[model samples]
Target: MSAPDVFAPARLGPVTLRNRTVKAATFEGRTPEGLVTDGLIDYHLAVARGGIGLTTVAYLSVAPEGRTHREVIVVGEHSLGGLTRLTDAIHETGAAVAAQVGHAGPVANGRSNGVKAIAASSMPSPLSMQMVKAATEADLTRVTKAYVAAARTLVRAGFDVLELHMAHSYLISSFLAPGLNRRKDGWAGSLENRARLGRQVARAVRDEVGDEVAVTAKVSLSDGFKGGVTTADGLAFAQLLEQDGTVDALQMSGGSSLMNPMYLFRGGAPVKEFAASMPLPVRLGMRTPVGRSFMKTYPFEEAYFRDKALQFRAGLSLPLMLLGGINRRDTMEQAMADGFDFVAMGRAVLREPDLVNRLQSERVESGVCIHCNRCMPTIYSGTRCPIIDLELAAHRDPLPQI
Candidate 1:
């Protein structure tokens, strides 16, 4: 009969979190040369200091060809120092740290990585306009090894959590979606077969990490496109993940950056703002009918994923993390009441890193992000809200560095 406490400490696998809030992974374009930077550490430090259970470092590519950007952090010897410092910095703030590891699949930027982007099958990427080649069996084996290696690296660097990314239409997500993964091989066709790569990665990472850290996964509840993975199938996939006995938790997310990104987070799409951040050619392309189709807007609401995530909670016994539209005490409380073990936030934390602290102290009702999604384009430059970082606005370049 009482509202569940959103700020109380909770168990997340091998670690005990200070609070139930998690700083969800957001791509920080600060990393250059596929290595860590002071900017990246500082970003997470702010979130950790603001008071959250864990802050996830975003999108570490397993292989160079899998990278969406040339400057994305690659789990390698060269990045050890930066990664260590990032974990140490978050730890100093008394917070757990996580790294999101995955291959970009068709989303891989051929212009940036100097290699043809890969997918479950040969298909042209709607976002990249690059033809993706089907990954060979050898490629899958190498990628699995890379996942294990990356998990080990994160644990060695003092991270408390490792989030295997199987969402957002990435390589793993592509395999899960029949629309993209048209292969007749063992890795395609049925949902069980399509989920093989993701399950393998989760299992490999869990095996490598042993018990040193919590291993979780992010899954797309829906591809938000027709003929894509359906909600019924997504629930089945979530059950499959738990049955696989690899990940400690399941985090729900959706939307395809290559298709309906607005579906991921229901909100206003800053089309002109996105176009303004690109080069002349890309800018012109954005103005075209085809380019304009990429930025479809969706209505914003608090706890947008609650209904869908609640279905997952009802069907599975594994701990689930509720994400999307968690910007206030009420929404966070709703998640806790609905049986989600943890709540993950991105734009809310980005706008106010201390939002968790504010919620705990009862200082603020909710975050003031406005759901404009103007900050979306800044991921290509540096992910800072235009409203909060005035300096960035003045120096906004015509072409954001890819």
Candidate 2:
């Protein structure tokens, strides 16, 4: 068969998307006081109105310390009304909405959270400048329950889907990382032990939500570093997740936010913009010999992860969503032709939320996002395209500043 049209509807587990387009979860620093803000809702609503099939609300932390910033959506009681409003607004725009849930673990902003960071093993944390504690069996149990609770909260909030953030060196990915997880017991050693935490959390989420909601997971296809979870292990883990019945769909992603941070986005973070946006301590840390070496950059390329993701498509039977560096009509067509179920856009959609509607035309080439990765640092200020903001300002004034 020929490549399916990009704008076609897609069914994801219990939910049905209006189109194959998914606005991938990009952290919008819109939450404040641990509650959803109108800005957060408006952000997703704009994407939904822009004609996305499903717009994901990003980084709803399972617990407080899981957040990379002090201000983020914490899965809790008072959030019910705001999230309900968010879902309603998106639904009104004729789009489905999903919530991306995760725990940041060692990558968390413990200083801002006023707690020591926890990880899969006790390790020297350059960021916190202290040894991060390894989670105990009790801690593991607690975190697993947190996932269950987050799923319930999402269901109550009227979210049609819950995308678990298991990739990017978070709580789950930390354990999966062999370099980070060196435990000798149940939580480490072999791949099976290392993958236990993710499996447990996924099972708990399924038990909690049952068929009432669709659950998807974003998993690292590779950590892009030595002694880390390799591409081979990532495929094994993906197979295990399917065997455990933990996901309705699997989204492929790579890189460690702590290790090969630049590997996630090949173009790399704009260091100058990142430093300018950081607090004094983080700013200074980035200049440190260690930090400077850690924040590496890579060249920009379209469909950056396609090569590895194709390897995944070859092995797994579960539906997969292709992410990373998809910015053009032809790229989406390639994904369809490759037998991928969905295509997710982060910077592409951020640059042009209406890019989906515009993609129907063969004349549309790609999004206006240059992929400079300048927006990486804006996590502290609300993640957005600086270019788009400048464009909006120019449109409002209709004049140049002298």
Candidate 3:
């Protein structure tokens, strides 16, 4: 079988990707005490050597308070040794590396970190159901500096790309959502106000990294919650980032922390009816029902957003990367045919580290990802893929319960 256009070379800002396939930022439980472990480095190297154009390191926290948990890799100036080694291993496999920088905000595990979780307002997360303290002006400033410091560290570590994680109910996404951010201050209320922090973070990163590194944003097209950030708002924010001249590319995703488990992991629901039977109230104003129904009929191998991703792309002039359930050559080709510049895969790489190489050499008929979402639940338990039998072959011991 011939490889599709997705395997073709493309430009992601200043860096040139060998193919459109990007290993989306998926957390591995290997980072211990904010330092990269040999297991993490080897995991990424496997994906890189497997033939991915780029591999993203997950949850590289800009600040200790922003950390989702203590196990996540810290990208501050103090934690460069492990990061540099990780990047070197990926580069050795001939794959470009991108770091996903984020702040967990109110979603940060307060019980795990023993620190007050902060957000745009004092709203509680539906998932964790914990109340977050409203961020003070000083807190916001400190977080912004943390992001800049992290980006500078990534550049120093020789990473080719930096992705600001502004989606999935993180600090930035929480601030952007009207339902989450009810503050009357300058950082809240209106769309422009909600986007202020993200814009500032992008600018600060650009200032720190300059033209040498590519800067991109992973933005939620819809929060999948009532009165939250909408596609219209996302389009506006993408324009804002573009106008600021700091963002090099845009990756579009949907759903907030409260809604759509399938948002990040496409095809996780065993039966299509299960996805259809999900409470529509949870999806509310977003066009999730329509998109979900379409996914049911099509069942593409790539990310779930491949079909509707162009809707967000059409609204922006910059390069757009589609993420979700992408896992096959045909689906990837379709994504390119529809104008997506990149296809981002998460669980596919988790299940089969050499998926890219196998696909390129026609050694595998299809990706090994079963889409069970067992990997997602493991994030809380210790963030490695539980279903990846071979990857866990060495660790036959029982995992500690979360």
C-alpha lDDT of all candidate models, in order: 0.84, 0.85, 0.77
- What are the models' TM-scores? 0.94, 0.95, 0.85
44-73 in candidate 1: lDDT tens per residue? 888899998899999898888889868788
Clashes of each: 0, 0, 10
Per-residue alpha-carbon lDDT of model 3 for 182-228, expressed as tens digits? Answer: 89889888889999999999999899888899999999877666766
Per residue, candidate 2 scores C-alpha lDDT tens digits across 74-169 of 888878788998899889999999999989888886777777778898876556555678988988888899989889988999999999988888
Give candidate 3 misplaced runs (Cα > 4 Å): 1-4, 125-130, 258-260, 269-303, 380-385, 390-402
Top model number, lDDT: 2
* lDDT of model 3 at position 185: 82
Per-residue lDDT of 367 in model 2 = 78
Clashing pairs in 2: none
Task: Give the least accurate 10-residue stretch of model 1, judged by summed lDDT.
Answer: 281-290
Q: What TM-score should be assigned to candidate 1?
A: 0.94
1 versus 2: better TM-score goes to:
2
